[model samples]
Target: MKIFKERHFFRLVIVLLLVSMASCNKKKNSYTAVSELDKKTFASTQLIPDDHFLGDASCKTCHAKEHDYWQGSHHDKAMQVATDSTVLGNFNGIEYKSQGVKSRFYKEGSAYFVNTEGPDGKYHDYKIEYTFGVTPLQQYIVKFPNGRFQCLRTAWDTKKHKWFDLYPDFKVVHSEWLHWSRGGLNWNNMCADCHSTNVRKNYDEATHGYDTKYALINVNCEACHGPGKDHVEAARSLGKDYKGNGDLKMTSQTKPKALVDACARCHMRREQISEYYNFEGSMLDHYFPQLIVENVYYPDGQILDEDYVYGSFVQSKMYHNDVTCTNCHDPHSLKLKFEGNKLCAQCHVPETYDTPKHHFHPTGTESSKCINCHMAGRYYMGNDFRRDHSFRIPRPDQSLKYDTPNACVQCHKDKDNQWAWEAYVKLYGKPKHKHFSDLLAPGLRGEAGGLNHLLELAKDTIYPEIARASAVNVMTNYADPQVIDNLLHFLKDESPLVRGASLDVLGEINAADYVNYLLPLLEDEKRSVRVKAFFALGSLDEALIPEPYKAVYKKVKKEFETNLKVTSDFVGGKVKQGNYYLKQGKLLDAIASYEAALEIDNTNNIARTNLANLYYRNGDFANAEQAFKTIITQEPEYGQTYYSYGLLLAELNRVEDAIVQMELAIKYMPDNIRPYYNLSLLYDKANQLNKAESTALKGFKKSPQDESMLYILAYIYSKNNEVEKAKNIAKRLVDLYPNNSNYRAFYNQLNAVQ
Candidate 1:
């Protein structure tokens, strides 16, 4: 009976194996058939054929005049082969070194080759197959055949006349960021979308790679003007008759909004939704839509940062006056529509504004220019030169009070804001302009002058909505019943942002009487306003909210819950929920939510980083280390993660590992201060006295006023036996933190030692 059972079992196993093999084969065949069908379907609906991207030679067939204008524009040579005609820098085997790294740019007959310093501290010779950009900054491109064509991070140094490395040495340490074997230096993912025309980053989900190629690799006129294929064909088929029918020009004559849309595609720093390709469909569709002044300007409307395109243009009265792009710039040539003062003269009378009498400088001198006085500002890079586009008078009073930049001090580098203010007072003598500057002065000095301005600004329609939002700063200082009542009126403003701001300001009052007024705003049309209202409602007395409003709040809350449920299938919804939880300080809940999301979709690195941050914040060092390590392994190019991990490691008391991690962090996120501060502390603990002092000094130089950084510097100086320096720092710390007895005692001890 036992022998019979064993034989039966063996037969059963064999039958099961045979059935599994047949099922596997069937699935393989089915997958192949389905893939083929999908390919066919995709091909049928593809926007443009692979062969449709004809070179410039084919474009010159009919529209010779248009082609001639394009040649002079920056777009024509935006990218080209590194021939003598295109290559700007002296590439005669010139070697350049920067930050302890070296690179050599040389030409071999018709071809250009560069031995560049890779991220790993090794010099690699890559053949320059293509050159990108025409002015400001240009990059070299090289193809790896089976791999991808990568744009080298090192750009040609035009002034220095050599090629310079842009990345640090540690980036090449077998990390994902520097691995040339895996298509390392491809700018297609980072920058190609804005620079190219009809770019399609055909990313394959299965392969996890991009099959990127472009119709035109630079910002062509056709890119902004729409595809010139149809227009060109029409012009060729029928001469001047093609005017209104086929030729769609992106000019003042055509759809004016198209020009702004074209510029905004690249210029505005908004989030991108789709792959870098798909220009027609991939632009930023939705953004945080409150038109706050800070979103567009500094508090004083002065250009504070490198917000070049949007900030200046949006603030100009030109935008309000319906002045389109073509009014200032010629689309074909891309130069200013007129030369010198003529550009400004288009709007302002030259006799009144452009003369030396008005500018108060010698004619033909640099300071005599209208841009020099009205729009004088600096660009962000090493070169602190370049005027601003926002044409406004220099309010030297605001500049003196707030230390904001002014047009006068820009040219007269020898003079301070005080000098400029005195000069302006002598010239113009304090005009009573109804600008926000007049309002912010008193608020900045901790006075109540902002109250009256806030009241006036809330009523004025001419002032931007942003100026009214600035009133929140002054509201913290002095309470005015009139201001509060006016803000209440804005609770029902047509703009959701204004209503949201009003709700936020109402929280300061915490008044039971205004609870009824705030309750209805909880059901605002905008999601952001509703979210703000929910929090504001939490601040008010529960009894004050009527039963009807409570029901409305519950309904709105239910709608959000239902929407979250419906969209929870996608990663975006999970991310949104995680953000909401993070903002509300529910850190552990956010971590769990993000972790669950990653379990469903492992490719979600954003969730992984967010979970790591939560763990770091909660003091769960072990989990934070594991999470950061996992992310580092998957994506080493993300340097900020390494810095965060180093911070966590330091908290864990793993000093040596912390040092190594901090070094790596500094190697990537060089500008960050946390790693430097922690590194200095670790060095002091290890008795590396000189290193600690140097690191602390560096940290102090970066952030002199940071209390923790000051404390660290003081401690480092004391350890180095510099009693005087240490006492000075301790005194500063004591002054900053007068309530802290520990700091006071430390300061006393330092003074005694000194």
Candidate 2:
């Protein structure tokens, strides 16, 4: 099986690369340009018909060999409606229990179904409408008429020889904003755009629904190959003139940038702007570029947050050395393009790498695999797993400090980092490498503990750009005037990625001096660097910097406009317009814009979030809560969403629900003192005086200088009749924000009560 998979991968690589090389000339031919330009001039060009979209079915006629190969690939079964042949789990009445909650899965003839407890604690039998995958685990879906579907925690019981609930006891609450009733787990909109062929999510924001159209569902070949209508029509007209090479000859195969754009669509960890975008379009136009940070990754660029495939790859030395995705992966089969040791031997010769002398492992041992020591496995969620793609050396030193698993200890799970480190040292004999370890050692060991080492590393060119960028993040935790100075220097760094990273750190400091330093970088050559600089300036003082940097801001603004012009004229444009209206405080305008934007792309969480905030401000708590819930479901890691949701829950008198949301907010963002302070207020309102006092104290301890916590503590103490303590804290708050009427009012009240 492995050998066959490898051979398939190699053939895919050869075909894809050859196609890419052939289409390397990105400049459009005169005739092609004239044709496109002419189409643009004709207003009534009919805008292409939906039926023109030929799903994967059409490709089978000319590319029989490739189509057959893909039929057995995982990509083929990536998503399907739940049925006897497609479903792989044991659905013959299997039951499982977790946390005292019971769930049952069973099949009736060809239909699969699961009986599980809902969030409200009632047993319900939901029919499994779709099956998601055929792998270590598969997800089942339950559909609704609104073109929304919920991914049931329950999965097919393939091994158990019966149907089993994947989420036996876990309860997932429905948020107003989530579309959980459409196609179920058919990968309709959420996972389909990148995985399948041309997918169009025809959503209607007014009705809060999707079009009940079959054409919009599933992956299609034209998705990656551009509009196959043109190619197909040409093939029919020219007959023998067109070559049917059984390769991915889509538009993306024409150029390196185009190929990278298509592959990165799914492989990279990025923030999506539009709900959907075309494969031939630029990635930056629709997605926010990911950085090496705690939110997206560990400081060391190891996977910490989510499975962002492209982000990890960009940080690797291999990427810098001109390695492309097609070099290893076959686009058609979506599998590795080479087999066994031979695959690794493509770049690493057997003369240098095949022996135990290089790998230091016995022949045929599990560790003998090329990826075992280099690409460590990291578990995401509780079940979904992935391996690091950065292709970095294992850092045993960091593994010991952060308890982050290292590649060395991962394969040798029983061994400690020390054991692995000693073995590595004995074999390699302390060879020098450019890693952040030298700078991180001091902070990791709790020695020489300010931002000194971090600042030095940020200024050092000897370290890799990614490592230096990582150091900027650590500096923010212990930011000082000197650290800010170092960051200013980084703004001028040659690498736009590094400059962008520096701006992020500068934003964290909230320093006026650093904001001034970033004004010039807004005009940097790279669009990413310019975007980061603008966002950083917005964070520092949005009102003030706009005028001073107006000239450069206008230039960068055009990049966004250009992106909108070239890309699909749908969700992307509406989202940018909505955000613009939002930042300008045109609430009604923003709402209308978001409504329009949602019509183009209902899965856009940012639009939903902003709309929710607008609803909350208008006292429409029900709608506000729903929007927040949708944001949470789509992106649980967005800590602030929970914080906002908790506030609305409190207003609705859902104290328990509010508390849970606030706790989740704290879990994701421990450094933010606001959630802790808000949680304490809820405790105080509930008359849990001791808990309220403790929670408030915890916030104060985390941010001793924060006046809000001080005020909250004083209020709690005053309510408890502890006048002396209340007066002291209130007096301190008055000194902090003297002009504030609320603090003075609280101070006087405390003094009088005393």
Candidate 3:
């Protein structure tokens, strides 16, 4: 119960947010039909002109050599119709089983099909519509009603020549989000745009369905080179002597930034800000790249989860020094331009870097391999081992200090971090430069002086924009007046990534106060930035805005909704839509969106959490109670549930039950101040004077800045006849909130009692 009562872990719970949320009105379980909701995927094949696209066959006549390299590359085979030539998986009536689920693959005439559990939780014979990905492992896609394409969890290991479950350790039930039949596995919203050329996710809001369309079923010539119609027309009319440039300005000689942007459109793990990728602007103009953050990357920004190359590559000095994709890999073939140290020799001095004096290992060994030391990779998609493009020094010293992954220990599995650190020092000596990881690792961990260090990193343009953006994002975790000012100031930063990241933080914490500062960004050049601005000002009162800015606001709001519509087919999208509706006071719409999210996958507790909160707000406590109970059973360790349930119990006058829940909440959500603040009040209600006073004192010690908890402590002190203690707290409250008449009145009352 007295968790966080000692020293600060630096994980500050921003006050009792639940207490404010409980005051919201509650209603009966009335959900809007998914079709009836205004949300849409807004994906349409008609948005762009069909004539603009010239298929791969149209380019082969002039670019024969390049076309040959592209013909059977992973990009060319990224997606295809399920045919004898394209289908890689064994389909000779072979049975595959994993985690209580079983599936049988076989052929039905020319079509491939699998007998497996579907959305209905019963085994059905589903026809394979397409094959997704080609190397290492290949996934099969099955079509559902309303144009949905679901990737089966059971994938074919191309290397192994057998079927295996992608989620081997996971218990993938049909009703779960990660199930092959659920939204997480839906190809239209998740993987279609990247796999195919000119994909339109075309999700119809009225049907809860998809009409997903693509120009080509694979990543074609037009996918990276923009629409090839102009180039084709120019080439045909000009003949061999004609040297006129088509509007499509891409080649092997393309600059690092432009070329990287074209590839990163698909490669990077990002948020789409536009409905259709018309190949108009940079990647930032269409998609918001995810930053290096905890869980996805280590605190020091090495790959932990799937960063998809771009996020990691941008952090390297190679990218900053103007090395494009074509420098290391043949863009058309998607193969390494040179093997092993030869690739490093293309730019790096082979005589210097390729020697044992540098690597301290024998040549031709895996330990001496340049990539194994610098660009240590991780296995993804079960079997596809992809290298980290960051190309960093193997700093086992930093690994020892910050606990981040390093190639030294990564390869030397038998050795500890300490051993690696000592061996590295004996080889390279201590690093001279003050690495950003030294600052970022501690900052992300919430260690002392971390926030200030992060602020310095955010302001420094010398660091990678993505790294700076990460610094900008971390500022939101702390609460301070100075933090708000710093975030607002960062809104004008040159990097769109930093600017958008700052807008995200400002919009989240103080959107209303930032109306004037945020208005200019509604017309931001980058769509990702503009959309972030819209969401930040999402809770803003439109009527209060200046009339001159109203139309621009409306336009960005439309863009914002369009961005949301693109992802509306996923559970995360529905939850976002629900939040959008909730903010607009459309209670029924919010409830429907949440319900629809749950409908897609019943185990999405995030959707249920919002739904339960909505039910509690609407005064339909019965449904709220049930939803909370269901969530507890579904995910027992979710601390917010116990805390929220305790609030409802208090409202219901179940004092003893509420006390138990509050205590449990504190145990689970130790950093949170709400449970401690509320529990003190509950203890007083139960007439446990000693416990009430002690708990109040501990809570006060934990968060001296929280006035509400301080007020509770003052009340508890007064109730226990400690008038002087109560008077002192009341006086301090008056000083902190000088003009508050409530504090003044309470202080006078305490003084009189004293």
Residue 442 Cα positional deviation in candidate 2, in Å, after optimal superposition: 8.1
Q: After superposition, how far is residue 179 of candidate 1 from its true place, in Å?
A: 12
| lDDT (10s digit) by residue, model 3, range 1-754 | 0001001110100000000001012211112122211213111111444566778888898889999999999999999899999998899999988888889999989999999999879999999998988888899999999999889888999988999877688686667666778766778777787888777778887787999887888988877776665556656666786464534545766788778876787777776677766644456656787787787788888987776789999999989999988898888999999888998898889889898888989988988889998898887667778888888887887777778889988878999999998987887789888767777877788776788989989988999899999998887666667888888899999999999989868765657777889988876767678888888877778887788778778767777787777766666667767777766678988888888877766776766877988998888899988998998998888789899889989999999999998998888888788888899999999999899988888788888888888899999999999999899899899999999999899889877762
For model 2, the superposed segments whose C-alpha errors exceed 4 Å read 1-49, 107-110, 157-189, 202-216, 243-261, 380-385, 436-475, 481-754
Which one is best on lDDT?
Answer: 3
- Clash pairs, candidate 1, are none
Model-by-model lDDT, in order?
A: 0.59, 0.61, 0.78
Top candidate by TM-score? 3
Q: By lDDT, highest first, what's the ranking?
A: 3, 2, 1
Lowest lDDT sum, 10 consecutive residues, model 1, at: 10-19
Task: Please give, for residues 260-310, the per-residue lDDT of candidate 1 as tens digits.
Answer: 645656554332222222223212221122232342345566665444354
- How many clashes (backbone N, Cα, C below 3 Å) per candidate? 0, 30, 7
For model 2, the local distance difference test gives: 0.61
